[model samples]
Every structure is written in C-alpha cells, then in structure tokens.
Target: MASAFELTRNMTIGQYIPTDSAVHRFDPRFKLVAFGVLVLAIAFCNTYVGNLFALAFCLALFPLIRIPVGYGVSGIKPAVPFIIIIALLQFFFSGSIAPGGTLHFEYGVIRITGDSIRLVIVSAMRFVEVIFLSSVLTFSTSTTDLTRGMECLLSPLEKVKFPVHAFALVLTIAIRFVPTFAMEMEKLMKAQASRGAEFGSGEWWRIIRRTKDMFPLIIPLFNLALTRAEDLILAMESRGYVPGEERSVYTRYRSKGADWGLLGISLALAAVILWLP
Candidate 1:
C-alpha cells in the first residue's frame, strides 16, 4: 500500500528512483542544465511541430532512463485542467506590443483581452514542461547529488552578497521534507476517507462545510511543519553552525569530461528550441 501510494503521490521527487538506464549514470549537473534548457526551448515553440518535437524528445527520454513515459505523463494529471483553462484564455486574448496595446479584437458585446491567448497557452505549456523535467531529474538523480550540483551552479551568486552555502542548505532542507509532508497529507486524506468524509456531493453552502471538515487535517499539518522546522534548525545548530559564516563542505563538487559533454548537448538542444522559433 505504501509503495503504491508512493507511486501516486511523491513519485521520488528530489529522491532517486534507481534504474539501469543511461540517464542514471549521467552527471547531475548535466541533467540540471538539460532540464532548464528544455524548459526554455519548449516555451519558445510557437508551431505545432515544435511542440510535438519537444514532446517526443521528452518521451524518448523515458525509455532511455527506464522510467515509463506513461508515469511521467501521469504525474501531470493534477495540473492538466489548469493548463486547458489557460490555453483557452490565451486563444481569446487580443493586442500587440507595438500598437500601444490597443483593443485587438471585438465581437458583439464581447472583446478579447490583449495578449491573453498566446500568453496563457505558452505559460501553461512552459509550466507543464518545467514540472515534468524537474520530475525527470529527481527520478534519475539522487537528491544529494542534485543539491551539490545546485550549490555549484549557484556559487557565482556569492560575489553579489548571496550566501550560496546557506542557500544550498535551505534548498536541501526543503527538498528533504517534500516526501514527509506528502506522507502527512496522505494520512490526513485517508483518515477523512475512513470517516466517510465525502469531498464531493456538496452544495454551494456545502463548500464551507467541506472546508470546515478540513480543519482537523490542516491543524495537524501546520503543527508538523512547525515541528519539522524547529528540528531542522536544532540539527543545524548542533553541528556548530554560525550565522552568516562560510564553512568547508562535507561534499566535494567535480565535473568530469562526460558531464561537460552532456552539458554541451543540453545547451545545443536549448539553442535549437529557441533559435528555431
């Protein structure tokens, strides 16, 4: 039961799902750059072929990584409805930037909003791609590896008054807790379900009743978050943390030749996506 639910809810976000596929052996740094590039490229596609190509590329990745394409697609089920609504809005939007944002379209008693349609579709598509790509990376690479890679990428920020080490620590904490929080919420849902709490079959006023029903679930989750935060802070301090101080990392960062090669490939794909459209 736990494993199946794990398949459903968390899906190894920020945790590695071990497989014998080529993707598993690739450097996390390479995956990170590839993931980010794929996002920008997918967003830039204005033509159907471009979108199809991007989709195909992403799907092709599943087999290479031995993570079923269906699983990756299914992960986005919760977000599809929002994507559809945004796409529809985008299809009706009106206006161009060059024309001082004049009313671009008018129908009897109705005018389409400027920059609405394309923006929404683009936004929704971009959102979906980014989410899936992140999932792919998480499913392929260990959370620790991803964190180390992020620290290296973000290291440049140290020159501009950013505490890169602290940033990495915070990111690491957030990633670590995603599954914990997911599990807690799942328990809340199931507990309500066991009590025969029907989330559906309610009237307009029933909305309030349903919301009130969530209180038992909400309070516990809030408490859990606070408790976890306190525990995390204590753990950090116990390890001799000093505020605003940099320290040597327990982990070392290294990028090999293979990592660089993959990084180049990721960049090339991104360039093709943007430069084409």
Candidate 2:
C-alpha cells in the first residue's frame, strides 16, 4: 500500500475495516459503480459550488456509512503535497493572462495571471475531490469484495480468449496481500526499534542514518515473504489446486434492481457532467 496517509498508511488493501453497515451490505457492484460515478463527478465538476456540493454530500453520507470520519480524512494526507505541486505547476503554465493586468511574484519566477491562478485553484479542488472520494471508497469497501466484483464484471471478456479469470485471480491475489505486506513492514519496524532505531531523529541526514541501520531488518522481511510464498505454493499444490480451474465461488455476488438503478443514476450523472457548461 506504500501510502503516506497515516490513516490508511499502516495497512494493506486486504485489511480494510470490517463492518455490517449498509455500505457493506449493498451489492459490491453497486458500491463500485457508485464510487466510479462519484469520482467522475468530482473530476468533471467545473465550479466552486460543484466542489462544495461534493464535500457536503460526502459529509452527509460518510456518517451514514458508519465509517470513522478521521480515517477517511486522514487517508488523503498522503496526496496533499502532490495536489499542491500540481496546482502550482498549473498556475505557472496555464498560459492564461489578461491584456492589462500586472504580474506579481510570491515565489521565484512566479508570474501571477488571473486565469492561471484560477486554473490552479480549480486543479487543487479537483485533486482534493478525487483523493477524498477515493479514500472514502477504499475505507468503506473491502479488497476481497472489490476484487470479486471486478472478476464478475469482466467475466464477459473471457469469450475472446482473454483469460479473464486468470486476470481476476492475479488481481485478487495482489489486493489480498496488501495488508499482509503492511504487517510485514510493521514487524520490520519493531525489529529495528528493539535495536535502538531512532525514528524521531529530526535531521534528514539522521533519519537516513537511522534507516540505514535497519537494512538487516529489510533483508529478513524480504526473505520471510519469499519463504512464505514458496510455502503457500506447496500447500496449494498439496491441495490439488490448479490455475485456471473452474470452480464455484462461495462469495458470489448478484446484481439486483437497486444496483441497476444505481448504475442508471451513475450514467445519468456522467452524461450531465460531460455536458456541463
């Protein structure tokens, strides 16, 4: 998961919070579809009011989902710097200026054009909008359900010799291991902590020095993962598990009328966003 967001930063995809809320009970397909539409709306929303509407809507629904607001909000922390950088770049390179307006500078070589600044603000809004929405989806949904939903959705691709099932299997495997990887990282941290790794060292050089001291921990963690993977393969082989084997899925998902309605509404929203003035 390699995310910098502390809320979700310490975990992997497989470790999404378990809940019995409506967010969890709803068909996985419905949730995924709703997420896609919401993200598209945020991305294409062109005005401040639109962005505000998104924030308000999220605020209203987040509580209903029974998810901790702090967790969802904190998951976006990792992207803040990226969003800021994009906005700055857009501001300078927008190439939009007025005939009689004066340029101003705050940082080096910063020529402030009205249009450029506006675009930058818009870009920031879009960035925040996307990250926050994505965080909400991830925080509210389990990786297992998401992978299963994808496999089901793409099953039609199997008709063209696409190995759709295999693709889904790989995706499921990758997502299922995210939390395991994070736990491994935490183990490595604890191992180094016992050896006096001063993580709080303020200086970048000191931080580097401390991290360098943990090389022994990383090596073991990597070795452990490889060993575990080999063991997993052996265990599966003993159980007669074969790749590309057709089997009944215990956690099958079915789309219902509500799901169809959600999809319809999503498409309508997409159409409206694409046609916005």
Candidate 3:
C-alpha cells in the first residue's frame, strides 16, 4: 500500500547515486560550468536535427557516468501527462510561429504546420535533454559538492554585494530536501492509510477523485516541511552560523586535467549540436 505513494522510487533528480565514475570525480565547478553551457545551447536550439543531436549526447552520458539509463529517465514518468498536454497545446495553436512554413492542417483558429511540428518535437527533446543532464548532475554530485561548486561559480557576484554564499546554501538545501520531503510524504501517506484514508486506490480515469484523495496529504506535508525548516533554522543559529559570512572551507577543489577536458568536450559538443542543420 505504501509502495503506491512512494515518490522517491521514481524521483531521481535530487537523489545521488555514488557511482564514483569519472563524471563524479570531475570538479563540481567544472561540471556546473559545463552544465550551464549545455543548458544555454539546448534552450536556444529550435531545429529538429539540433535537438536530436542534443538528446543523443544527453542519452550517451548515462552510460559514461555509469548510471542506469532506466533509472536515470524514470523520473520523467510522472511528468508525461503534463508534457503531453503542453505539446498538444503547442501543436494546435502554433500558427504564429508557423506562418511561412508548410501548413498541415487548419480548423478555424487551430492550425498545425511544419514549423509547429518542429516546435513541439524540439521542445520535447530539449525538455528531455535538460532533465537527463540535471539527473546526471545530481546523481553524481553530493549536496556539499553542489553548494561549494555553486558558491565558487557565483563568487565573483559577491564583489558586487550579492549574497552568493547564502543563495548557494539555500539552493542546496532546497534540492537536498526533495528526497527528505518525499520520504516524509510516504510516511504520512502510510499513516493516513492506516487510519482508513483512501489514497491512490481508484479508477485511473477518475482524475477529480484522485486529486481529492491527495488533498488530505498536502496539508500535513506542508506542516511537516515547515516544522523541519524551523528546526533547521534553530540548529543553524545555535551553531553560530552567519549567512553571507566568509566561511572556512574544509574541502578546497582543485580541477584536474580531465576536468578541464570534460568541460572542453561539453562546450564543443554544445557548439556542434547547435550548429547542426
């Protein structure tokens, strides 16, 4: 019964799988930089061939990083319905972008064309690429690594009075708390189910009923999250931790040749993919 509400099973974004492959060994700073470059390239890519190449590059990283392809992609399963709806909307009302392209179908205001098809396909591919890259990043890097990496990457912003340290800490905490919240929700679901609360036990097509059933779990989850956050705040305050303060690092990262090579390869790949016809 609890298995039905197990979010962590398919939630791979915030979860780390310590495979200790070369990808994991790369300096987090380099990894973050590479990730940013690839992300920007993918975002601007609107062509079918470009997106296909980008997606292929992203998919190939799973094997290189030693993460199971199935597990890495399983996280997107829950988002399929939402993605489908958005794709349909884009496909139907895409006349603006497809004005000069080949027209495929027209029904009053709704129009489908070559450009529309390209848009939908490219958008979906970009989404999958981003998800895959993100999953790979989190799967290889730990919360500590992510925080330190982000802080280092954004450190220059501190010269202009930006709260880089605090921002990095907050971001890392938000990510780290995802799996925590999932586990908490699982526990809450099980508790509620023990007390005769129905959850995830209805016809698949009954969306309204399913949503209503989930309402009972939402409030408790929020309360639990708030409580945990408050406790974290108290603990941090007790430890004399000051936000935006110059913190001493116990682990200073030194990038290796391979790390530089990895970043170079990523940049080259992004450039090539974006240049694809």
Best by TM-score: 3
Off by over 4 Å in 2: 1-14, 84-112, 203-239, 264-277
- What is the descending TM-score order? 3, 1, 2
TM-score of each: 0.76, 0.71, 0.90
In model 1, the worst 10-residue window by lDDT is 1-10
Clashes of 3: 0
- Give the CA lDDT, 0 to 100, for residue 198 in model 2: 47
Residue 199 displacement (Å), model 2: 2.3
User: For each candidate, what is the lDDT?
Assistant: 0.68, 0.65, 0.86
Deviation in angstroms for 270 in model 2? Answer: 4.9
Superposed on all Cα atoms, model 2 deviates from the true structure by an RMSD in Å of 5.0
* Candidate that beats the other on lDDT, 1 or 2, i.e. the better one: 1
Which ranges of candidate 3 are over 4 A from the true structure? 1-3, 97-99, 195-198, 201-209
Best by lDDT: 3
Indicate the residue-level lDDT of 187 in model 1: 72
What is candidate 2's lDDT per residue for 1-277, written digit by digit as tens? 2231122353322445666666667787677778778787777777666666566666655576676666555545545556666776877766645787555554555666776776777677767666555555555677667767877778888888787766876776666665566667666766556677644344433434645655766778788788878887899799887878876777867777877886786677556555545
